[model samples]
Target: MNNLKGPVRVVGTGLIGASIGLALGRLGVTVHLVDADAESALMAERIGAGSRDVAGEPQVVVVAVPPDHVGAVIAAQLAATTSAIVTDTGSVKSKPLVDAGALTDDLSRYVGSHPMAGSERSGPLAGRADLFDGATWAITPHEGNRPEAVELIRELAETCGARTVELSVQDHDLAVARVSHLPHLMSALAAGTLVDAPASHLELSGQGVRDVTRIAGGDPRLWTQIVAANAPALTTLLERIRGDLDRMLIALGKDDGSGDITNLLMNGVTGAVRVPGKHGAPHTDDATVLVNIPDRPGQLAKLFADAAASGANVEDLRIDHSPGLAIGQVELAVKPASVDQLVKVLTERGWVVHR
Candidate 1:
């Protein structure tokens, strides 16, 4: 399971597919890249991800196309070869299996998987060899799926530096609706709020607003298909969010009885704390140390070097630039045990440290 053997055919040349190829190829696995767009396949090949030519029988076939196209493409791949095990990286799972009915009835060799990693970018150009490092890659296999085939799929995920998890197709879909699809819809909705705003208001916006709406910049065409394909699950989640918004609105209309607003805000505080922190573990409230950094090329690097010199591991970092000043505030999150030492180290290194 450590190294993938034999030829692996990838039926898409986008970020996930190309990244899989790059990870496998680097480990000396033979990878064959394919895409409906010939140029995309060629581009992935040119990037040393894999070759366009697939000669012999493949040991594995990865279908990494759009959500709606997954079932059809997986069916086609199954029709093309009965020897290889097939898997897909689509977000939705149950719908595709239902769509692929007969093709998946003998689902011994087919599995559905999704890697919990990606930027709001696509195509071969955005592929990274380490895209899946330490990321959870969920695998959903039918009750009758062959164990060996599932093992091979897990091996493929591990080869790409991803942790493997097994989940039912239904559970997988529901989990993603809460954690992924709902977030995307919310981000898009938040970003849409700015569509008609005055230019001056947008100009004054800072990183916090940008962070909330970052995923809104994804390809609309792709996202539309994704949202539509998973509409049932997404709609349910959206309705719950709508209910919360309704409560907040009603609270705003109340006179002298707006305790509901505080309750709603407290609910958000509770929910936000439930989110997993660094390395997918329970959240820990780390100490924040803010330092004023000069607007210079190597200032950030120097700050990190100083922190390392003090042996204080920086758990997380964020930066905010002054509107009209030649400086930025670098916020560093460190363990409580290391905060005092880090502040002392930075102060000695001529950094204006703020706790």
Candidate 2:
């Protein structure tokens, strides 16, 4: 693993920021946590994110503040630091880069980065060292950017177990507007519709509804900042989706055997399958096994043990549990070739596997 020569400074000890600090600190590099909220910064330090004070000139500085505040924070950090290579973990980049350009004449030392990793949770207490593991981190270098500085930021990301991708700021924002931002908005909308739903309707909700609405539980304040910052791209994407939904509705209401609705639904299925998997590679033909696990201690451990003994690699997994359900569904993703083998192993071991 690559190491930094000097202490690394992390601004904003929220989930992403504190996570960067923790990951770097674990790699034997001294990390300095600088947040506008002193107590939060101190709490991050307490959780092993980094030290409390800026001891000296840091070699690299990561700005993990909210998207709206990223530009100002990056500018201030660049002005204050002696000569550190500065980067950010904000979700949107183009606007911040433009804002930074307006704030400072020296832009060579700064780079814009966004890690495609986060949970619905927020704050320093929610940070985990492995938050960036196997996730993509986009690095955007502008005209005045220093090659060394860009490489240093890449090294820092690699050390934190993130796969780095180079993209123009515009491309990054536009792409995420579809895959990330739009999804958050969709989930929030879907979840909001349930607010006035009848109690019986809510009780009937299955894993599918819950899965699609998970991001709705995120911090509203943070999301308000993100959605507002990336409004232009998100609005465009949403408009397209709106048009498609309108067409689908019209097609669904048609009495004649119009194939438009079927075609649209099929297109959505095809689009979803094209999404890359954990390693930045396309997922292969695979099957997911849903196991209803009892809500008790050691149930998850036993499930994993059976899976391991089955000689099948688990590509992905998700657990769905509600307040009153005695059982939670564990979705285990396995290669198509190994599905039968895993099913036999699981069934023979007496674990209830969903068909």
Models, CA RMSD each: 1.8, 2.8
- For all candidates in order, the CA lDDT equals 0.88, 0.87
TM-score of 1: 0.94
Q: What tens digits encode model 2's per-residue C-alpha lDDT throughout 1-355?
A: 3546658889899999899988887778889898889999989999999998667789998998888889988889899987899999988988888788789888889999989899877899999999998889999888888788888989999888899999988889998898888999999999999988999878887779988998888888888888988888998999999998999889878886379888888998898888887565576555899888889999999988999898999999989876576878898988878888788999998888974
lDDT of 1 by residue, 303-344 (tens): 999999999999888898767789899999998999989999
Model 2 regions more than 4 Å off: 1-3, 281-284, 289-303, 318-331, 351-355
- By TM-score, how accurate is candidate 2? 0.88
